[model samples]
Target: MAISTVEATGARVAVVTGGSGGIGSRTAVRLAEDGLAVVVGYTANRDAADAVVTEITANGGAAVAVRVDVADEQAVAAVFDTAEDRFGGVDVVVHAAARMRLSPLADLDLAVLDDMHRTNIRGTFVVARQAARRLRDGGAVITFSSSVVGLAFPEYGAYSASKGAVEALTLILARELRGRNITVNAVAPGPTATELFLQGKDAGTIARLADQPPLRRLGTPADVAEVVAFLAGPGHWINGQVVRANGGIV
Candidate 1:
């Protein structure tokens, strides 16, 4: 599948928030591959966002880069409005926007927890709310969770808490949309080999983390993207579930 094939129809549009970064970037491209016009939303890093747009365009896929902070209602509304105006209406929403703050519960700073909550919990709600409003009746909404929510790692308390909220939101949102044919779900990924995962780790630390997965390897952006594509495209029946793309890592 190529972007050109997607541009041919031009009615299906997908919104991928935080698309300038790891999993979000790959998921945007993969959706384009599956024939959906893509809206790449970013908070910062216009260059990265533009690069994704350029790549899609160069490949003959229709895409645009939109800057919006998903945490703000007005900003998220603007993103949906742009998608409606540019590509007809939203058919898929991949809510990949998130903030990561790692600290043990004993040492966790309240400010850090608050900031993460603002982005992960509030941001997801804002986007999901807009998605609930603007998405076509049969459209799908994909939110991001984390494998740490299962592992209960020591230093991941703040991040895990935010994702826990997301899990709850996904479940209720799917129920709220019942009988509407709209599917809502979350994707929880293990330690993937992205810039975000590399930020605070040495190579040995990264390798040790990778070794923990049953597959004995870290995940790739494409690994998670494939799962997103499935939920957005063929996995419509998988509603209100947190599909883990963690390569068997708990």
Candidate 2:
């Protein structure tokens, strides 16, 4: 069955990649609350993505779940197509889908590096290209990066490198958009309490990393979502910049 959160009422639309994941799920809900119709893009776990859509609908917000492979240009394009076909047009894009494999540069498996680049780096570019071409005037494009890019933490090289490319793309794309009135920016988050981050680490390690932030606590998905909401809505002047959403971790 096709589910929709709220009736489309000519509201702005947002396509959020990785909408089944931690921060991405929260971001989809937040944008819906902000009066934008949302298309939640997920690679796997249709049930998880459906749950997010269900929550948004239950809250009287507008949302739909779509399957997308971030690395697949056609799939990503179809996500945007669904948004436009279901709603009106896309005004905001949050490319938060990514793959994180922690390893030092030396011992990292070559296949692992290939997978990371295909999804993280190449996927970001593919999505960004589509957003740049299709986003309406006064739209916003937000990409995800990690605070580890600045922390230079061990075992984060491959992931950080992919995000670094995202940061660079954010800047140049903003300039390239020139008179389009679109804002392109990257959000670099610090250590957040997401399942992706908590999976393999011991409790002690997680606690230690959380305490590194001056706030002395890990960031919640909601915390990051707020920043995304800002960039997508009122943060119009913040183009071509990376807003570090980490709580003083870097």
- Give per-residue lDDT, candidate 2, residue 156: 90
Tell me the deviation in Å of residue 143 in model 2: 0.3
Model 1, which residues run further than 4 Å from truth? 1-10
lDDT for each residue of candidate 1 in 87-149, tens digit (9 for 90 to 100): 889999999988897788999899989998999999999999999888998889999999999
lDDT of 2 by residue, 1-250 (tens): 2468477888989999999989999999999899889999988889999999998898888888999888888988888888888898899999999889998788999999999889999999999989988899999999999898899999999989999999998899999999988989999999998988788899899999989999999999999999999999954588899999899986
Top TM-score model: 2
lDDT of 2 at 150: 95
* Clashing residue pairs for model 2: none
